[model samples]
Target: MIGLLATVPALIAGIRALRDRVLEVAASGATVVAGVGLLAVVLLVIVPSFEILPKSARDAERYEQQQRLDELDDIDAGFGPGSAEEAGQEMQEYVDDALQLLEVAPRTMRTTTWSKSGTTAAGNTCRAFHERIRLGDQVDRSSSAERLRTAWKAESDHTSFFERNGVLELSVHPAAATISWIRADNQLIVESDCIPYAAP
Candidate 1:
């Protein structure tokens, strides 16, 4: 009977050891499954970002380009010469500077003119002279506008004053500048000093 009792204790210890080993294996297997699941979740999130990265980069590039264009538009509005002759001279000077900046000669440069009738506070007749400077395909209008704006900002102190018929207008004391983007021709139309011509 004493020998039987000793054997029973050994049997209990052996059973306990087996139970502990089984529990350890189950815990290890659960941990492995959970780790694999976490890895899968991470991949699911990461893979889409990789696919979207290029598109996000493209969007950022486009936004920057648009910002540059808008800034150029604002800058274009600030240039104006006091008279028709001065307007012509100033336009040529601007074109020359723009060509230097762009490193390209315009295929063609042309000007058009018209007269608008206006009434003054007094009974005198007033005429507003409008001039449009058109540059040809050799000059990229958008780039030229940007360069011209930079040059104008450096040379003059002015700010955006108004908008009329989709054209942006700016004033510098006795002179005014009108800037418009011609989408169909991919050109820029700059009307300078479109105010009543006053004789000195």
Candidate 2:
């Protein structure tokens, strides 16, 4: 009877150990599954955010904004004329004079592409090239000479005055000092230098 009792207890202990092993395996499996689920959730949330699609979208938006800014700058720089007839007249007058102030007018005009721009000066709204100047039919030579002198001043005063007076708006700088103009036809133009045209 005692041996029988001992055998019963040994059998119970064996069964209990088997049950605990199964429970431990189930717990380890649950832990692994939970960890995998969390990893999947993190990947789903984070991977798309770093993907190329969103980054490219942001880059495209930035490029569009930059283009809009350039267009606005062009508008502000005075590249358009209010009236075609007036633009033509301005171009024609410039052709006749050939910018005597800057002998480079013809050559520079030939070398560089001309484009229309707009600017305001002396409270008058006039359409002209930002980097070029074309005198009105009544433009005084002394006045033009004075303009040249002011531009060639040893100090940077000429550049400041040019902006303040609206003599020439330099949108595009050149290798050498340059003058720009337009003809009555509203054609854009440039001159390398106009100091030679100034009166001695």
Candidate number achieving the greatest lDDT relative to the actual structure: 1
Once model 1 is optimally superposed onto the true structure by TM-score, how far is the C-alpha of residue 152 displaced, in angstroms?
A: 2.5
Worst 10 residues of 2 by lDDT: 191-200
User: Which candidate has the top score in TM-score?
Assistant: 1
For model 2, residues 116-159, the per-residue Cα lDDT tens digits are: 43333212222332233434445454455554555444334323
Write candidate 1's Cα lDDT for 1-200 as tens digits. 34334444544554555567756555555545555554555566556768798899999888866665554343355434434445545455444554466565444656677656654443223345455656667776667556655655565554444444433233334344444445346444555543333334
After superposing candidate 1 on the true structure, give the runs of residues whose Cα lies further than 4 Å from its correct spot: 1-107, 121-123, 158-170, 176-184, 188-200
Local distance difference test, candidate 2 = 0.41
- Where in model 2 is the C-alpha error above 4 Å? 1-34, 37-44, 47-151, 154-200
- List TM-score per model, in order: 0.38, 0.27
Q: What's model 2's lDDT at 182? A: 29
